[model samples]
Target: MNATAKLDEYIPVVGQAIIDDLKLLAERLAQKHVLHVNSTAVGGGVAEILSRMVPLLGEMGINTKWEVIKGGDQFYQVTKKFHNVLHGRPDEVTPADFEIFMETSRKNIAEMNTDYDIVFIHDPQPIALIQKKGQNKWIWRCHIDVSKPHPIVWAFLKEFIVRYDASVFSAPSFSQQLPIRQALISPSIDPLSEKNRELSPEDVDRVLAKYQISRDKPIITQISRFDRLKDPVGVIEAFLMVRKYIDCQLILAGGTATDDPEGLQVLAEVKEKAADNPDIHILLLPQNDFEVNALQRGSDVIMQKSLKEGFGLTVSEALWKVKPVVAGNVGGIPLQIKHKYSGMLCNSVEGAAFALKQILNSPAFAKRLGENGREHIRNNFLLTRHLRDYMLLFLSLDYAEDLVYL
Candidate 1:
């Protein structure tokens, strides 16, 4: 995004009516101060979306500030365990983990003064910060899939979640029957960001050459963190199966998040599974979005076969680029893909392999899928719509009764 990007600048992409509505909404919430608190300022989908969201809120004339909490290695380790348990993984959260989380939360509560009209907390990292709430609105935004979390871990987190004015979920299934009002707000990708913006053919070629990745054959890519739940290993298995008939190369690329301690472990496991396959290109990228955009644009097909997900933002990103996507039929992926319409959704490795083969074998079908996908993302998953929903959420907070169904 440009340094001086205005909401008006998005008119060319999202049209004039959307921008006008945002201005009107901002006028309603004039002089109100909003604060957003999360763990990391970089990496992951939360940081990525907020990178665009905060500045746009300011452009709308709202006093918006984004703050990140400080944590040590142990604190992040405990939170990563909580993330896994929240994703329905087996309960391995020890008593020590709770102590670690609270110990760090106490320091954060003391050091940071969260005195604003509204304090918006993202995920469970800063969830305990609600203890300091005093006659102000607080929104807990859960960016993970907690549909079927481990009972004990849910009980532990639920204690803090219930204190908020409202909780926001990415999908309806993720909403747990919480006491507070709930809002279903899906995540989005910035169309103007370096990761999603348009790139020249030379730019794509330069990035491909820089990485020594040859597009001699068709390229299939899965851009995600080296997380176990993303199922990079299964992606490799599916690619190997597809390679038997269709000649193609696989690109497994992503950077680690500061809040996720299991990243390096997962990356190592992925490397071991990849072995000495010359066709597999595993790029451990930095927080570089331009190169990511270039790679995604250069690929023949994009895959986001996550075993568990909050809302697969990459699916939207790929679809926006008019790329055919093959993703897991889990979490929020189905919301973006309509099976044979926009893209293909699979349940297992065999299913994914079959889907990939279909796309590679049929050129006209792939083109039609990509065209439909771009339209789907333009209408429903753009940043403009996301901004509208959030402002509506802020307005809904003014109501006393259950009003956050926006």
Candidate 2:
């Protein structure tokens, strides 16, 4: 879809007030050049947001650019370990890991273009880009939960992070009380995107048929990367418990990110755990957005069994589709779900299974929850809201004293 047309759809929902607000913000930041640096241009949520955000920012008269840092296999492996450690996992991040990270960061620093008014650095992979920051408003956009990060890893990264003018985190709980100013900006899904757009029943069925997913039985699906933090294995365990009472199938589908070196290993472990279970489908999708939309639409119950989630975009995507989601009550999952109102929040596999069974058994209740969930996302988690928040944040950085004049 074109940029103007896509932004117009928000008129009915967010109304002219926000559009006008964006216009004023755009005018205020017209001369400002914004650049976003991340690891990949696809696969991850940061990329997905930038794909829609940068274009809109440009359309709004801001000079916006997106750049990705290149890293080797070993570098990515080290970054992946850092990702886990940041999520509170006790991964042994050796001294060699920091050395490799610095080596790659040095290479990226030497070659990267850092000529922008505001530099937004996304995640840990490209975080070191801030090391090369000059006279610019460099904002570190951390799309992960570092509430309980490994001391060693956090300390190592802190050397580069503390240099930023500001930092953005998804949730308040995810934020660390650093000396720098912090902004709470939640991640959002594009409703007009292939993954959340309105789909016809024929399209949904065609997608299911292509994947050989049977519609005869109730399908409980979780769409996330095959990562341990996503808890794909725990999703399987929850599915098994749900299957004891409900005759349903479980679909765990996701694609790997370029920077995530542990995807294949995690996928293999998930396959091993679901061995010989025909009812369980482990699909390694090729980052196809529409297929994910169809799978969520075709499912009777959608789940996000994330043990540690950085807002869990899949949950927002499912909720946008009006699907009753049973997600873990951790990180940003609760921010998306209001428990019994929008959707049920689960703490463990058993809790998730129980919630899944409830949703599967009561169609009316599930439908009601789905409708409410969709409304919740429509009001709060859409790309338009995210853009507004970002624009406000940008303007705030400029008018640091009286920014809340709105």
Poorest lDDT segment (10 consecutive residues) of candidate 1: 397-406
RMSD of each: 3.1, 3.2
Across 1-406, the per-residue lDDT of candidate 2 in tens digits comes to 3334456676776678877878887888889989988999876678867888998888899999999999999999999999878877777888899999999999999999998889989988888888777878889888988888889999988888899998899988888879888988999987777777788999999999998888999998998888887899999998888888889999999887666679888988999999979999988898687798899999988988888777777888888888999998888888999999999998988898889888998999999999999889988898888988888778777666743665
> Distance (Å) between predicted and true CA of 62, model 1?
1.3
Quote the lDDT for 159 in model 1. Answer: 95
Clashing pairs in 2: none
Candidate 1, RMSD to the unseen true structure: 3.1
lDDT of each: 0.90, 0.87
Tell me the lDDT of model 2 at 334. 89
